[model samples]
Target chain A: MGQYIHLIFPLVIGWGFAFAVIALSHFLGPKKNLKTDLTPYECGVEVVDLPSSKNRFDIRFYLVAILFLVFDLEVIFLFPFAYIFKSVATVSPFLMIEMGVFIAILLVGLFYVWKKDVLIW
Target chain B: MFGWIYIALCSLLVMFAILMVSARRPISSAVFLVLTLIGIGVLYLMMNAPLVATLQWLVYAGAIMVLFVFVVMLFQLRELNPTSISTHPGRFALLLLLGGGFLGLCLKGVIVGLQEQPVIMMGQTLVTGEASLKDFSLLLFSKHVFAFELLSVVLLATLVGAILLARRKQRVS
Candidate 1:
């Protein structure tokens, strides 16, 4: 509890600071609004249809996002493995083989995705 | 003070979950869902389970929500209109029933927890070094080793399924 109690102070400070800045902007910032200011700007360069609700996106985006989801979870599983592999290493040398096999399975999944040609675009 | 903070975080989580379910735009709903997920992480932090909280944020709020938002955007590819919210009276009844059921379960959990106290699921409270991570790793690599490998197999299956799902439309055309 002592270790976690220290986190509370930082949480309060971060949230308080954010709320203060946002409230200050609300109270002190200029309220005047111009039509041009409302319009979306295209990087202050050639306006090539700025990203908005109206623009059509690609289905590949979903596929890539799913792929990312798969591997991101795979990466997360590594966190616990790494956190205690050293401890386990001394106890059982076979632990490395276990981790190796786990990783190799995911590698096969990666290979399958690569072969599917989803990684091209 | 900690109790008050915990209650506040819990209330915020409930509010955020409500906003997520009933939001107008899909993107906004996903954003609200992220807030709810982070609120859950904050709750975990207060419980002294820093590893669970960190994983909650990194994997759930960060990675999973990114995928959710991208999928929501992908919906924009086929349709321009905002996804319509349910308006049927039966839908309202169903929502209310689900909401009430969830609230009851949560209330019951709180009551039972308060009566029995929190269960320490192993680890003699690591005050100095790594806390839950070490305990979790021991359990994962020892007790739940088979489940761990099975997760990889499931992921592989999902990868294959997703690729096939995505390729179906292209093949049809």
Candidate 2:
């Protein structure tokens, strides 16, 4: 725990920098209390047909999100494999084969998605 | 000092979790859930498992949260009326009973473990360094390689299911 205490320094610096930037912009930026400027759609254009909040999104978006999540998990699994690659490779001959099989299984899915034209849009 | 920080973090996580469940808006609930995940990731860091903590942040807080928020947006649920959620008192009571029983069992286990000081790493010895990671990776690659490969198959199944369900159907030519 003591060894990891230094990690908190980056967190402090990051939050401090973010707050500083926000504070500087709020105080330094020019401000005008104009009703026209407060409108939802600015640039002297009246609001067009506003999209309703109740509108359901296309299923394609959700599909993309699901794909992203699955691939993100794949990356997570790969991280540990990469960490102990050298040491494990020396000890076991099947190390590369294990990782190859893992990736190959996922690659089958990738190919299936590609053939189904899921990646086109 | 670490204990104090851990206690504070746990409290923060509990607050976020309650807010996540009770929030009126699903989007707000998702945001609060993201906060809870981050707090859990911090807890992992406190446990001296940086790799696990980083994975928790990346997989749970980042990618999984994005998926959850996307799901919230996928549905047209701008206004969530509290009364609209159907509640069955009998089912609720049953669930409460089951959950309470599980919690009690967990507490019993903890108390028993504390009473019997087993040969296990508790505090300082729990520091997970490169050696521990290597040990884990070796086990994963050697003994648990089948499970690892099986996970890839699970991911593939998920991908295929998503595309099959969501893909736009083409009319016969």
Candidate 3:
């Protein structure tokens, strides 16, 4: 419990500070009311919907997110590898093969995404 | 005193976080959030938990927050209206009071703990330094092996789920 609290304390402090600052800003900042300001801005164009449109976003957005996640997880695995590379190299040549397989999977996914034109803007 | 330094760092992080939340552009907010995360990571380092600091960068900043920013950019949500946020004076006051009480309790607890231990500032021991990487890897494989496997499984699931979610359904025209 003590260790947990020590680990969590900084996060709590950060969140608390963030909330307080935002709340303070609300109280202290100048008040302005205008329809234009309230309305959602779409690439500098006026929003067609009065409230807001609930349009489904293109799948490419999700594709990009998934690609990012794939790369991020790859990096996570790489960190430990970096730390223990020398020891692992001495112990097992198989480690390189395993990593190669992992990279191959990621490469396949990337190729699939590319073929689907998900990378295009 | 270290207290003054802590306070200064905390203030800087708070200011950055506020700027992040209030920034009109999502990309700008995302960038500010990165700074805030790094600031928090530095706090972790100051607390003498390099492992936790690395995890903070790897998990929260590197993965989760980037995903958040990617979604924000993709969706292109309009800037939040500052004024439209309903303000309740009494509720805000109560929340502030509660927050203060929580902080007071935390401070008291920390002081007591420090007094008991005399807060021995551990130097870079073999276990906590670059030299310990081999031991760390051994510990991960032996003791934390289950966690390592579970993380892999989670990543695999995430990949499959993401691909499924992104797959476009063909319409029978």
Candidate 4:
């Protein structure tokens, strides 16, 4: 409905170009096999650990992720509020208090999480 | 042309949703669900609601799904055994009932909203630069202020509850 065609236009072009290059290489490029060539990239350094499913991530990883999500959600909600703040403020100063209440609650959550030592390794 | 994209997005959403439910692997299910979320965002974009779409992308698809992946990794959960999942008929029945109830509620809301479109249009006409957003904020703060305040309380409870749940309980000597 809108002129959002520009948004996807570059995306379509990029994908088409990528696939074209990949296909061209597959057809025309040499398929020689070498041990060094097949080796996994190591950032020009020695590879540390080969990735496998046997290693389990620490629980703290998930905990940190959850905390990140909670605060991330708080930020996202603030976007709409911030977007219309000036106009809303002009209408009624009470509008600011509404957002203040929301932020205060999240700040409480942050304090709770902090006191609980959830952020510690 | 836009209609075709909308159809494609809807089909993608439904397909990924099905994949999310039916996939045996936890990782695959999370991935499929993320795809479904992206499809929903794209649909929102097509509908010219960039704010909602961006919010969906940032919060739901990005943050929430990142957390889900971490959860899946924490569990190190691989393929779900079909026999183990499907064997519990009672749980299955309960799930079916709950899903049906939720679906019915959604359908009812959609029908009611359609019938009340004219009333909603009064608020709809204010679509402009930031006036639409300001209008929404005013409506939310003025009309739904109580509910908004309640939401903060709910978040506070959830925060406390989550911390309590996550904390290691001390053992009695």
Candidate 5:
């Protein structure tokens, strides 16, 4: 229980600090009222709808999310490989082959996306 | 005094997490979510899991959260008009009772467990000598080989599926 308490103390301190910062900003910030201030700005374009409603997002958003997940997971493979690399240097050929297949699959997906114009900004 | 401090912090984290979930503005929610993550990270550090705390920040706050923020920015959500609170008093009462019951059970368990386990020096074991990064890497590749391979395959499948889902259908005119 004491160990748990010790662990929780710093977390409490950090949260308190963050809360104070946010509260201070809320109280100190300007409270001027204007039609323009109320309007949503989208890349300098006047927003047509209220900012909180569900809005259409570009296909790029999903594309990027997928890409990020793929790459992030792939990076996890490096963790174990790095740990045993010294003792397993002799098995480098097999490791390279496996990694090659992994990269090839990702490359094929990238090509398909490019062909479909999903990669185009 | 220390116990009170911890209770205060946990309450704050829970409050921020609730605000993050219910905030109408995506940006505001994202900011609060960051705070929640940081609070959790600090908790991990206090537990003497500095490596886990660092990973929490790097993985959740630095990487995954940036993607969330990027998506929010891409969509450019606007401020939402406030709405009336739920009027279902019975449902609210039930939810409160269930939550309170869970809390009581957890507190009872903790108190019971505390009577048996004594607190030892928290950081002494880890402070003796740091494990080499090489040891961790070796364990991952050798012992966790199947998991490592499976993750790679999953990534490959997700990449293909994402590309396929996001593809624009070409209309034949």
Candidate 6:
């Protein structure tokens, strides 16, 4: 618990700096209420679809995100095994088999995705 | 005191969660959800599970939030107008009751835990709740090995399901 006390300094300083910057700009900066100023600047181009809803993106972006999430969770689960692999292996040789099985399962998923051409796009 | 810090983090988490659900814009809601996840990660750190906290931030706040934002952008949802929200008093009351009951159960568990005496091991009180990375690894790889392996299978299913659902259907021969 005490070890984490030092982390408080960075958090405090970071948030303080952010709030200070925003506060300073709000209080000191020029306040022009022009309609042009309120609009989003897009290299002086006319804004289109700024307020319109239901813009559809390519489905592939969502697929990539899903793939990333699956692999990310797999990595997180591997962390504990990697941390204690040696110690646990000394107790029994089955630890290796256990991790192998885990990876094998995920590998099948990866193989399935590869075969399905999900990663091509 | 740690208790004060814990309470502050819990309240902050609750505030962010409320903001997440109530925010009009999908992007704002996603951002608030990230803040709520970060607050939970900090709470995990305070509880002496640094590894869990790091994973919480990495998996939930980082990867999951990325997915959330991507989905939001994919849908390209605009702000929800307040007038468009239909109110149902019965549904609201039911939700309130469910939330309150869950909160009460959690508070009761906390109260019971605080009332319990600390375990004395060899005449020295053991730090009961401290879960360093080494301790976490020992438990995960030994007694919980079955559950750990099962988690991988779940991930595999999720991966295949996600890919199958997201990918365009193949043309039939």
The numbered model that scores best in TM-score is: 2
In each prediction, how many residue pairs overlap at the backbone (N, C-alpha, C within less than 3 A)?
A: 0, 0, 0, 0, 7, 0
* Poorly placed runs, candidate 1 (over 4 Å): A3-36, A42-55, B77-131, B168-173
Put down candidate 5 lDDT per residue, B1-173, tens digits, no spaces. Answer: 22433454565577667667666688988998998898798676555566566667767886678878887887777766743322334544654554465466557556755665444424344442235445555566557756766766676677677777767677213
Q: Candidate 5's error at B160, in angstroms?
A: 2.0
Candidates arranged by lDDT, highest first: 2, 6, 1, 4, 3, 5
Model 1 chain A poorest ten-residue lDDT run? A46-55
What candidate 6 gets wrong by more than 4 Å, as runs, is: A18-45, A48-54, B83-132, B169-173
Candidate 3 lDDT over residue span B38-94, tens digit each: 879877766656766778887778877878887886677776665322233454455
Tens-place lDDT digits, model 4, residues B1-173:
33444554565466567557766788988998998898788887766566777789998989999989888877778676774443555645555554555455546555665666355332232354355556665676778889877877777776677677666564212
Runs of candidate 4 with Cα error greater than 4 angstroms are A17-55, B81-131, B168-173
lDDT of 1 by residue, B1-173 (tens): 34544665565577667667766677778899998898898888767778888889998999889998877776654423544443444645655655566566566655655666454323335452365568778889889989998998999899999888878345322
User: In candidate 3, which residue pairs clash?
Assistant: none
* Chain A TM-score across all models, in listed order: 0.72, 0.79, 0.63, 0.71, 0.59, 0.77
Q: Which regions of candidate 2 deviate over 4 angstroms?
A: A28-30, A42-44, A50-56, B74-76, B82-128, B171-173
What's the lDDT for all of these models? 0.75, 0.76, 0.65, 0.71, 0.65, 0.76
Question: Considering every candidate listed, which one attains the maximal DockQ?
Answer: 6
True-vs-predicted CA distance for residue B70, candidate 1, Å: 1.3
What C-alpha lDDT, on a 0 to 100 scale, does residue B83 get in candidate 2?
37
Can you give the lDDT of residue B36 in candidate 2? 88
Give the interface-residue alpha carbon RMSD of model 2. 3.7
Chain B TM-score, candidates in order: 0.68, 0.71, 0.61, 0.67, 0.63, 0.69
- A6-104 per-residue lDDT for model 1 (tens digits): 666998999999999999989998887986577778666545654674656666788888888889889988988887877778888777888899899
Ranking by TM-score: 2, 6, 1, 4, 5, 3
Q: Model 2's CAPRI class?
A: acceptable
The 10-residue segment of model 5 chain B with minimum total lDDT is B121-130
**TM-score, structure 1 vs. true:** 0.70
lDDT of 4 by residue, A64-101 (tens): 77777777877776776787777668978876888898
TM-score winner between 3 and 6, please give it: 6
